[model samples]
Target: MRNIYLIISREYLERVRKKSFIIVTLLMPILMIAMMVAPSLMMLYSKSEQKQVVVIDRSGVVADNLYESAEATFIREDGMSKSEACNIYNEESGIFGILYIGEVVDARDSVQLITNSSSSMLLEESISSQIEAIVEREKLKEYNIENLDEILAKIETNIELATFVNNGATEDDGEMESTSTGVSYILGIVLGMLLYMIIILYGQMVLTSVVEEKASRVIDVMVTSCTPFQLMMGKIIGIAAVALTQIAIWALLVLSASKFVMPMLFTPDIASTSGALLDGALGTVTDTGYIATLFAYLALFILGGFLLYASLYAASGSAVDSIQDSQQYNTVIMLPIILSMIIMMTVFNDPNSPIAFWCSMIPFTSPIVMIARIPFGIPTWEIVTSLVILYLTFIAMTYLAAKIFRVGIFMHGKRTSWRELWLWLKE
Candidate 1:
C-alpha cells in the first residue's frame, strides 16, 4: 500500500510540475475564450465596404424601379448612349460596375454588366434578385388585382417554435422543461468527443509510460520491491488522478471566463440583452443548470473509459520493448473507439432508438454513446447500467493484464507477437 502511494505521488507530481503541462493548462482556457467571443465581436463591429453601381437603363421603364440598398447605390443615368456611359465609368474611381439593359429588359442577351474588375457573387446576386422581383411583379400584373405587391410583401412570415418536454404536461406551466434539439445535439457531440479524446490520450499515456520504464530497465529495479500487479495499479491510478486534475482546472477556467469575462465584452448598446444571449444565445436553447450535470457525467465516463482501456494498454505495453513495436496492438485497441464515434454520429438524430440503447449497454462503446445520449435526457437506469458494466469490465481486464505484465516485465530483447501473448495468457 505504501509503495503504491509513493509510486502514485511520484507519477502525479512529476507530470504536474512539468513546464509543458503548466503551459497547456493555462493556454487552453484563453483559446476557448477567444473562440466563444470572436464571432460575436466580428458581427458587432465588422463593416461591409459600400459599392456604387452606375445604371445605363435604355428600357427607361426599368431604371426607376432599381433602388439603393446597404450593399450598393444605384444611380440611373438617362439620355446617354452606352459608349458615353462607358467613357464616364472608365474615368470614375468609385464606379463599381455598370448595368446595361436594352429596350427589352426581359431578353437575356440584351442585358449586360460591365465591371472595373471581376465582380463578386454577392453584387451579382443582389442585382439579379432585384431585377427578378421587378419582372415578377410586372408579370403578375396580368392578374389585375389591386395592391398585389403590398399584399405579397405583408404575407412573408418568420416563426420561432419553442419545444418543451414534460411527458404530458401543458405547454405553459407546471414542471415543463424547455428543450432545444439543436443545442442539445451540439452538447452531445462535444461531450462524446471530449470523452473519446481523454480516453485515447490518457490511455496512450499509460502505454507509453510502461514501455518507457521497461525499456530503461527501471521496471526491473522497481518490481523487486513490489508485485507486478501493484506496480501496474499504481501507475494507472496515478495517471488517472493527473487526468482528473487537468479536467477540473479546465472546467473552472472555462466556466469562469464564460460567466464573467464574455459578458463584459458586449458594448453598451447590446449590454442589456447580453445576459439572455450569454445564457442561451437565441433564448431557451438550453438551461445553464445542465452544464454542471453534463460535466459531472463526463468525468464519470472519462474515468471509467480510461481505466478500461488503460489496463489493456498496460498489457500491450508490457509485451513490447519499444513504442514502435506497439502499432499493431494500438490499432487493435482503437477499432472499437472509432466505431463508437461512427455510431455516435448516427445516433444523434434518433437517440432513443433500439440501436442506441443496445450500443449504450455495450461496455466497449458505452462511455461515448452513453454520454451522447445523456444530454437528450435519457433515463437514470441506462446511465447506471452502462457505468456498472464499464467498471466491471475494467476490473476483469486489469486482472488479465496484470498476469501478462508479470510474465513480460523481465523479458528483454525478444520480439513478442499476438500468438505469444495468447500463450502467455493461457499459462
Candidate 2:
C-alpha cells in the first residue's frame, strides 16, 4: 500500500512539474477564448467594409425599390449600357459586383449577378429579396389593396416557446421543471466534446508514460519493489489527478473571462448575444443546483471513461518496443471512441430515442453518451445503472490488462499477438 502511494505521488508530481504539462495547461484556455472571440471580430470587420454594387435595372419597375444597407450600396445606371457599366465598375476598387435585373417574366429565374471576382452570397440574397418584395407590393397595388402595408404587418408574427418537465410528480401533485431545448443541446454537445477530448488526450498520455518507462528499462527495476497492478494503478491515478487539475484551471479561466473580459472586448449587442449563447449552453448560470448536478456527472464519466481506456492503453504500451510499433494496438483502442463521437450527432437530435438509451447504457459508449443525456434530464435509474455497468467493466478490463502488463513488460524484440495475449491471461 505504501509503495503504491509512493509510486502515485512520484508519478503525479513528475508529470505536473514537467514543462510540457505547464505549457499546455496554460495555453489551452487561451486557445478556447481565442476560438470564441475570433468569429465575432471577423463578423464586425466584414460588416464594416462597405461593398459598392452597380444596379443595371433593365426592368425599370424594380430599380426605385432596391434596398441599400451599410454593408452594400446600390449604384443605379443612368444611360450607360450593361457592357459599359461592367467595364467602369471593374475599374473601381471597392465595387463588389453588378446586379442585372433583366426583363422579369419570373423574378426568381431572370435576375442575374455579375462580378469581376467571386460573388458574395449575402449580396445576392439581399438583392433578390428586395426585388421580390417590390414585385409583391406592385401586384398588391394592381389588385387595389389600399392597406397592404398594414395587412402585412398584422399577419407577421413571432412565436416564443416555453418548455417544462414534470419532476417525479403527477400533474396534480408535482411541480413542473422549466427547461430550454437550445440549452440542453448546447450543453450536451459541449460536454460530449469535452469527454471525447479528455479521454483521447490523457489516455494517450498514460500509454506514452508506460512505453517510455518500459523502453528505458525503468519498469524492470520498479517490478523488484511492487507488482505490475500497483504500478498500473499508480500511473492511472496520477495522470487522472493531472487531468482533473488541468480541467479545473481551464474552467476557472473560462469563467473569469466570460464574466470579466468578454464585455470589455465586444460591443453591447455582440456581448448580449454572446451572453445569451453562453447561458443557453450552460443553463442558468445562477442556478447552483443544476450546475452542481452537471459537474458531478462530468466528474463521474470523465473518471470512469478515462480509467476504462487507460487500462487498455497501459497494456498496449507494455506490448510494444517502440512508438511506431504501438500504432496497430492504438488503433484498436481508438476505434470505439471515434465511433462514439460519430453516434453522438444522432444522440443530439433525439436524446430520448432507443439508440441513445442503449448507447448510454453500454460501457464502451456510456461515458460520453450518458453525460450528453444528463443535461436534458435522464431517469435516475438509468444513470445509476450506467455507472454500475461502466465501473464493473473498468474493473474487468483492468484485471485483463494486468495479465498482459505482467508478462508484456519484460518482453522485447518481438511483436505480440492475440493468441499470446490469451495465453498470458490463462497463465
Error of 2 at 418 (Å): 1.0
**Model 1 Cα lDDT, one tens digit per residue, 18-102:** 9988998788657644544554565456665667888888777677888887567887887777788888887356688788888
The root-mean-square deviation over C-alpha atoms between each candidate and the true structure, in angstroms, is: 4.6, 4.3
How would you encode candidate 2's per-residue C-alpha lDDT over 1-427 as one tens digit per residue?
9888888898889888999999988897787656545544554445645678888877788878777776578888847777887888884556777778777725565777778777666766777777777888777788888788899778878654545676676657635555666657666877888889999998998899999999899999999999998999999988888888887787677667766676566546654554433333322333446755676778788989999999999999998888888898889898889888887888878888999999999999999999989878888899999999999999999999999999999998899987888899898
RMSD of 1: 4.6
Best by TM-score: 2
Residue 177 error, candidate 2, Å: 9.9
Runs of candidate 1 with Cα error greater than 4 angstroms are 36-47, 51-67, 70-72, 75-136, 162-190, 266-279, 282-288, 342-361, 372-381
Kindly report which residue pairs in candidate 2 clash with one another: none
**Each prediction's number of clashing residue pairs:** 0, 0
